[model samples]
Structures are given as C-alpha cells and as structure tokens.
Target chain A: MDQFLQLIVAGLATGAIYALAAIGFTLVWQTSQTINFAQGEFVMLPAILVLTAAHLGLPMGVAFIVGSVAFVLLFGFGFKRFLVEPMQRHGVLPLAIATMALSVLIKEAAKNGFSAEAQPFPSLVPDGSVSVLGAAVSVRDIAIFVVAIAAILGLQAFITHTRTGRTMQATAQNPTVARILGVPVERMILLTFLINAALALIASYLISPVYLAKFSNGETIGLAAFIAAIVGGFNQIRGALAGGFLIGLIDNLAAAYVSSAYRTAVPLVVLVVVILVKPEGLLGRKEERTV
Target chain B: MLFKTMAAAIALTAAMTVSAVAGTVKLIDVIELSGPGAPAGTNWKNGSDLAVAEINAKGGILGQQIELIHYDSQTNPGATRAAVQRAVDEDAYVVLGPIFSGPISASMQITQRAGVPQIVGGEAAAFTRQGNNYIFRTSLNQADSMPKLANYLRDEVKAKSVAVVWINNDFGKGGRDSMIPELQKRGIQVAADIATESGQADFAADAIKVKNANADAVFVYLNEEESARFLRAARQQGIAKPIIGETTLLGAKVIELAGEAANGVKGHVGLLVDAPKPTLVEFGKKYAAKYGFTSDHNGIKGYTAVYTVKAITERIGKLDREAFAKALHGARIDVAQEPGILIDTKWTATGDVDRESFLIEIVNGKPVVKATLPMINP
Candidate 1:
C-alpha cells in the first residue's frame, strides 16, 4: 500500500513534466497542422542557456529567463520562416523534414557550443524529503509537480480568457474564416510557435534538476511527448494531460508490478490499447479532414 | 653511347634513393579528439599529439619521423571502421584508437586483415581474445575487471543483497553478465537487475524499482550521460545505496550532474595517484598546464598507450607488424605512468596486461584514490 502510494506520487510528478512537453507538441500540431519534430529541442533551450549563463557566472534565475525568452523568439522565427512558409507553398512533408533537420542541427549546436557534458541546474528547492503516508517524497519532485500543475492551469486560463488565445483558437478552427474575420493567421501561427518554444523551456527548467541536463535529452523527452500526444489525441489539450498521467502511471505501476525492463514498453502497450479503443484519443473530438 | 648510358644510370640511382627512404613508418592515430561522452578533463588530442611530438623531437625512427595521421571518429563504430580503412589506404604502419568499445570492435577486423597493429583504448571483455594477434588493448578487459567488481562488493563493502542496473549495450551487458555469475559465487543474493536504454534522461521508473528491491548496493554500468542522469534520478526518488560501477562515472559531468548526491558513489578506474614514475608526474603537470584541467582515465590510457608503443618500437627497432605484436605481449617496463610506480609486465596476452584498477570512492565530492586492488589474474 505504501509502496503503491509512493509509485503514484513518483508517477504523477514525472507525468507533469511529460504533460508540459506534450502540450508544446499539441500546440504546434493544432495551429500549424504539422508536427515540429524539433519541439523537444526547443524544450532543451533553457537548460543550455542556463549552462551558458553559469559558465559566464550570471545569476541562475536571470540566465534562465533570458535563455528561455531568447530561444522562444528564435524558435518562433524559425517556424515562421522555414515551416510555415514552406508549408504554405509546397506541403507538410517538407515541414516535417525541416523540423527533424532543425532537431539535429540544434542538438549538434548545443553539444558543440554549450559543452556536451551533463551539467546540473542549480537547485531551487531545499534539499529535503517529506514523508507523506509511508512514502518519502523529495522537495524537488514536489516543486516540479506543483510548477507543472500551475503552468497547465495558467495555460488553460490564458486560452480561455485572453483575446490572443481565442484568436489563436479561431485561426485553428478555420484559417480562411479566421482571416476573413480579420484574425492574423500568420501572426497567430507565429504566436503558436512562440508558445510552444516557451512551454518547452519551462518544462526544461522544471525537469533538468530531476534529470541531468543531457546534450541529447531533447530526443528522449521528445519521444515521451510524442507518445503522450498520440495517446491524448493531438488535437485535444486535456488529452495531453490525460495521456501524460496515464503513461506515467503505467510506467511506474509496470515497474512495480511487472518488470523494470519493460517500464517504457508497458506504457507504450497501454497507449496502443487506448488508441485502438478510441481513435480520437481519450478526450479528443473527431475532426473533418480536407481531401 | 657510354656518356648517354652514364647519364641514365645517374638518374635511375636518384629515383631508387627516393623510394628507399619511403620506409619511414607512418602510424595513424584514429583517436576521438572531440565527441560526446568523452572523459572529463582529458587531453586526448594533446596526449596523441605529444606521443608524435616526442617521437619526432627525438629524431626520425629509421631515418623517417613517425607521421601521426589523426581523424576524429566521434566514438561511432561506423565512423571508426571508415577511419581505419582510411588509415590502411594511407599506408599507415600501425593504428591507434578511436576509443569506446563499439568502435574498437567494429574497426578490429579492418585492421586485422590489413595486418595493421591496432592499439585500442577500451576494455570491453568481449572485444579481447578475438583469436587474431592483430587486436590488442592496454585497458583491462571486462572479464578481468568485473570479477574484481564482484570481489569488491563482497570483500570491501560487504554488500549482501545487490541490484544491478545497466545499459543494454555490449559494454554494460558484458560487465553485468560477467559480474552476475561471479557475484552468485560469492553467495551474494542478487536482487533486481534492471536494464535501461542508453542516452535516456529520465530513469525514475528504474530508480523506483531499485528502491523497492531494497538492495544494499546498486551496480550501475552505463556511459557517462546515462550514468549521471541515473544518479540524479535515483537521488530524487530517494533511492540511496552506495552506487558503484564502471570507471566512466568518474568524469566531471557525473560529479557535476549529481552534485551533492555524488558524494559517496564508488567506481573502478586506473590508479591516478602520483608514484615513482617521473614521466607520469611530468606528464600530469604538463597536461594540467596545456589543457587547463586535471587528467582522467582517458588521459592516462592515451599517454600509456603512446608510451607502450614507444617501448615496443624501441625494442623492435623496426616497423614490422608481427614483431611489434609479439613485443607487446607481456613486455615489462618499470617506468611510472600511474601511481605506485610499476609496469611490472608487458601485455603478453590479450587477456592480461600490467594494468591495475584501483577502487575509487567519492570523498568530499571528488574521486579520491581508495585502496588499490592488485590484478586478480595479471
């Protein structure tokens, strides 16, 4: 029982980090209708930036914020120039290739520029573990989980309340109609790229301490995010959260109940079953496709 | 007619002389000068450069300066094979490392058929004793080292219940496979042996399993990247048992990534302390001055490999591959490359070398030399 509760806490905390990464993936997919395979690279920005800042002896917080905002803009501009422009003329395949290429480029650049060695993010939370029930939970895990939940809620509020968010949604619903209604489709698409990049940075900042900031961590995180996006239905924001938590739960539970060797494999199995049952995802709505 | 024939003979003699000195030995160093997961603070580039530099500075071997041709393999196996082939095509007399087990294994066949003496810098046990005289390593093989790991767990730490976590690659798999049988023989109860993917960032699930298994110690075998992440995740999940494994964890990244959590982890590595070897101290001081950081296992391995080549080359006095290979076997040199000051024996066999891996534990957040365990076989 105690062990079970421990697994749940550990899984939920990890699930939150995956949720943030998945949300970024979903945003790019929903707005652009093309997956930015480099979405994980955007997520690794803050950690790299922080590392760079640490090398320069800048304060951790300042370095993180500057790095996060700078990368968000850089990635946003890249999407606008490379992905959106190419997709407007040619097709989505080019955009996919471009994003994957970007992923490789960004990974190599980070390794060469920031030093490929794994560097720790300076700890923000106090080093302590609190006993909840019989399971001991580290302060860092709790902080990460709380930050993830807060970010998700904040994003939900932004989408529901903000004019730009609604305009972005309007653009997603019908790009032609949204343009007819004076919604800047190009600008909204750019905004989506920025949002995805920013969210990815946020996720990196939260997760780097828990998982050492690796040069190729983006690929690892990206794969989990892809799994989450698929399980949650790429079109549904709530689906991402659901998918992330479900995958995380299955990962932990499987390790405990089954075999640790299949920790990653088991979650994938559950995701496949869920996808089979509901092709639209757990909370996703069916969308009409254009021929 | 006599005058024309004398002119032709003089020209022919000049051509023949030019071709004779072409016997100058060209040794190719296929080492990784830069790549991901390289050892911390290692000057492999400089170490490699210094070997050639010293050899050239001392004057040409057989009237030809040893030419060191280097190509970065990026520690990839495919790249390594290509690099080896390039070296062979370039007519290199001998080839030295593109470190990392996979690359070393991949390039073994290429060098063997070409009769090029390939001095590798990795210790994966599966890589050794390939039934070819061409493949040789100064680094200790897994079969030779892993039994010592099991012995350390039983005798040094007195660990009873042990859980093993490793990457599924040849390096990790070899270590895990060798240790398990030996560990069982020591009457140690094996707990959970969890395998994780190489280059993975999140290891929370694996950490939980280790915690749940309640093992007294966790033996983790992975490259630097995954090992560092695993340590951080294990700490976050509150799974604290003295983590010990391969020498790769002694890198700066591992210590930096794990930070406070890296305090007590133990690992196996070549002895780094200063001993009677005058060259080692001189090399150490020079390396620190050149690279602006302290040396790691790779620096020593690279330095020692060059020294071994020099010793063997000096003994043979000629660039014969078969002769050099024969000299490498159990050839003893008393010069100090590592602390405790003894080469004691030259690598007479692929399985045994004059190498000793000292037990290292993190003391004060740094890898301090612990007790030295003599080679079980060598």
Candidate 2:
C-alpha cells in the first residue's frame, strides 16, 4: 500500500512537469491554430541559457530572469515574427513543418553552443526526503507539484477573468471575428507564444535538477507533452492538464507493476487506446462541423 | 678526384639521413566526435593527442614521425564503417578507435577484411570473442570484469539477493547478461532484472520495484547521466540497499549529478583518478592542464592504447600492420614505463587486455579507491 501511494505521488510529481508542458502546447495550438513542434525545445532553451549564465558568475535569480527574458525575446518574438508568422500565410501544415525544423535547429544550436554533456542544474528547493504515509518523497518534488498546480490555477483564473486573456481566447475561437471586433488578433497570437514560452521556462527550471539539462532532453519531454495534449483534447487547457497527469500516472504505475522494459511503450499504448475508444478525449467536447 | 668522390658520398649519406627523419607513419583514429558520445570521444582524442605529442618528442616511433588522421563517426554505425573504409583506403599503419560497441562491431568486418589492426576502447566482451584476430581492446571486457564484481558482492558484501536495473543498449545489456550468471554462480537470487532506455529521466517505477523486491543489493548499468537519475530516484524511494554499479557510474559527472544520493555507492572502475600511481598522477595533471578537466577512464584507456601501439611497433621494428597485430597478440607492457592501469599489462590471443578490476566507493562526491581485486585471467 505504501509502495502504491509512493508510485502515485511520484507519478503526480512527474505528471506536473508534463502538465505544464502540455498546457504550453495546447495554448499555442489554440491561439494560432498551428502546432508548435518546437515546444519542447523552448523548455530546454531557458534551462541551457540559465545554466550558461550561472556558469558565467551571475546570481541564480538573475540568471533565471535573464534566461526567461532571452527565451521570450528569441523564441516568442523573434521566432513567431520571422519564421512562424511568415509560414502562417502558407497554411497550418507549412507552419507546423517550420516549427519541426525549428526544433531541430534549436537542438543543434544548443549542442554546439553548450555541449553534448549533461549539465547539472541546482535544485531549487533544499535537498532532503520527507516521509509521508510510509513513503519517502523529495522536498523538491513537493515544490515542483505545488508550483505547477499554482501556475495552472493562475492561468485558469487569467483565462476566465482578465480582459487580455479573454481577448486571446476570443482570437483562438474565431480570429476573423476577433480581428473585426478590434481584438488585435496578431498581437494576441504573439502574446500566446510569449505566455507559452514562459510556461515552458518554468517547467524547464523545475525539472532540470532531476533530469540534468541536456540538448536532447527537449525531445523526450516534448514527445510526452505532445501525447498528453492529444490525450486530453487539444482544444481545452484543463483537459490537457488532466491528460498530462494521466500520462505521468499511467507511465509510473505501469512501469512499477508491469515490465520496466515496456515503460516507454506504456504511454504510447494508452495514447492508441484513447484515440480509438474516445476520439474526443476524456475531457474534450465533440463538436459538429458544417461541410 | 678522390676528394670530390668523398664529398659526394658524404652528401648522399646526409640526404638519406634527412629523408629517414622526415618520413611519416600515419595512424587513423575513428571516434564519435559530435553527439551523445562526444564527451567521452573528446577525451579519447585528447588522450591520443597527448600520446602522439609525447611519442614525437622522444625521437618519433621507429624514427618516423607519427601523423594521426582523425575521423568523426558522429555516433553513427554507418559513419563508423565509412571511416574504417577510409582508413584502409588511406593505408593507415594502424587504426585506434570507434569507442562504443555498436560502431566498433559495425566496422569490425571492414577492418578485419582490410587486414588493419584496430585498437578499441569499447568494453563489450563480444568484440574480441568473434574470432577477429586484428581487433584489440584497451579496456576490460564486461565478461571478465563483471564476474569479479559479482564475487566481491557475494564474498565481501555478503549479498544474497540482488536487483538489476540496466539501460537497454549494448553496454547495459552486455553488463546485465555478464552479471546474472556470476550472481547465479554464487547462489544469489535474482530479485528483478529491469531494462530501461538509455536517457530515461524517470526511474520511479524501477526504483519502486527494486524497493519492493527488498534485495540485498542493486546492480546498475546505465551511462553516467541515467545512472545519476536512477540513483536519485532510488534514494527518494528509500531503497537503501547497497548499490553496486558498473564503471560508468563512478565518474565525476555521475557524482555531481547524483549529489548526496551517490554516497556509499560502490562500483568497478578502470581508472580511479585518486589512485596513487605516478603515471596516472602525471597523466591526470597533464590532462587537466590541456583539457581544463580531470581525465576519466576513457581518456586513460585512449592514452594507454597509443602506448600499446608504440610498444608493439617498437618491438616489431616496422610499420607493417600484420606484424604489429601478431606482436600485439602476445605483447606485454612493463608497468615501469606505462601506467599500472591495466593489471597484467598483456594481451590474450583474442586481443583483449588482461586487466585487474578496481573497486571504488563515492565519498563526499568523489570516488575513493577501496580495493584492487586479484587479476582475472582472460
């Protein structure tokens, strides 16, 4: 029973990371109607940048801020403006392909600029394990869970209550109508990219200590988040969050009970089952389209 | 007329001496220079570079300057094959790397068919076991080392049941296979044998399984980063059983990444940086000065590989690959000239080096040598 509880807690902590990354993916897809395949690379960029800054003798807080600002300016503004926006006119397929290319470009650039070696990230919370209900849990894991949940709740509130947030949602729903209503649809899409970038940065900072910041880490995290978004329904933010948690839980629990050899395959199996059984996902709504 | 004839003869002798001094013996190094294996590959290159510098400084190998040609395998098997073919095409006197098992295995047919002597740093026992006469290993094969490790766990640690978690690659799989038989031979129960992907970050499920199994010790065979991740996860899950790991887990990178969780973890190491050997000490200091980081086992193995080549070439008194391979078959290096990194300092007929395995435990985020095991015959 303790083992069961431990697995669940571990799953949730891991799920929190996936949830944050999934939310970022869902946000960009909803706002621009184009998938940002490089969403995972965005998460990696901040961690690498912050690690580089910290190595250059900057304070941790200052390095983190610089990393966040750099991510926003480069990926959010520079990437969206020059690459994504130009391809947007060509269609969603082209834009998505461009993002895929961008993912490779970012990965190679990071490898060349930094190193292929995994760089250790300092733990944000103090190092130590706390026993909870017969299970030992790291304090950092708890901090990650709390921060991820808080960020999700804050995002939910902003989407529901804030003017700019609602305007962003309006643009996502019907860009043509939103633009006609003076919502500045282009700016809203860019703002969505900025918000997603910030979310990715937060996830990277939280998880780097566990995984170690590496050039290729983005691909693993990104693939999981991508599957999470699909499983939760791409249209809804809360659904994506729930989907992320489900993946984390299923992945951990399956690996524990079943064979660890098939741990990586467990999530994919769940994805296939979800796609076949519930095409709309657990929390996604079924909407009819006029032909 | 006699004076002119003597002057011509002297001029001819001087010209011949100058030509002999200027002639070059080319060696090819095929290694992964850019990818997942780059860190270790870079160290391998540095080791060879240091050896080449030292050899040339001491009046060259057989009076001919050694010219090293390097090819980046890019961590691809296909690229490694091409590099080996290129080495054969260039007629390199000897070929030095392709450190990972996959690349080495992939390019073995090319090197063997081309009749070029290839010295490798890969630890896969199967590399030399395949009846390839020309291939030689500078590192201890898992087949030979893992038994010693199992014996240590059984006799010294008194472990009865052990759980094994390994990466699902050639190195990890080979290590797991090698360890299981030895553990079984000692009547130790195999609690659980789990294999995970190479760069997997989450080890919660694996750790939980090990904890539930309640094994006396855990044997791990993941590369440095994944090893750290597993250690962190295991410690978090409160699995406090003594963890016995593969040599890859004892590096500075693993220690840094695993932090306090790495404490008390014991493993087999090829080269312990803290070992009180003058050769290793001097090599470590020189490596730090050149690379700005302490040399690990890979760097040491790579350095030793060049010396092995130098030893063989010097013995045979030529740059012929066939003769070099034959000499390496029964060659032995004196510990006085070379570092005592390899135990017996000799190669078996199969081209695998006979080396003693060293045990190390992580104390305060650094590997401290515990004991040097009795030499295991190849």
Which candidate leads the pack in TM-score?
2
Error of 2 at A126 (Å): 3.3
lDDT of each: 0.73, 0.82
Question: Which regions of candidate 1 fall more than 4 Å away from where they truly are?
Answer: A56-61, A126-128, A182-187, A252-264, A267-271, B1-25, B31-46, B58-64, B251-253, B273-282, B336-345, B375-378
Give the TM-score comparing model 1 with the true structure, all chains together: 0.88
Candidate 2 lDDT, A141-205, residue by residue in tens:
67888999999998889888999889988998899999889999889888888888778888998
Alpha-carbon shift of residue B223 in model 1 (angstroms): 2.1
The CAPRI classification for model 1 reads as: acceptable
Residue pairs in steric clash, candidate 1? B329-B347, B329-B348, B330-B346, B330-B347, B330-B348, B331-B346, B332-B346
lDDT of 2 at B113: 85
Task: Identify the leading candidate in terms of lDDT.
Answer: 2
Per residue, candidate 1 scores C-alpha lDDT tens digits across B55-138 of 678764555676677787876678778888998777676787866777788888997886667887776777776776777775
DockQ per candidate: 0.44, 0.53
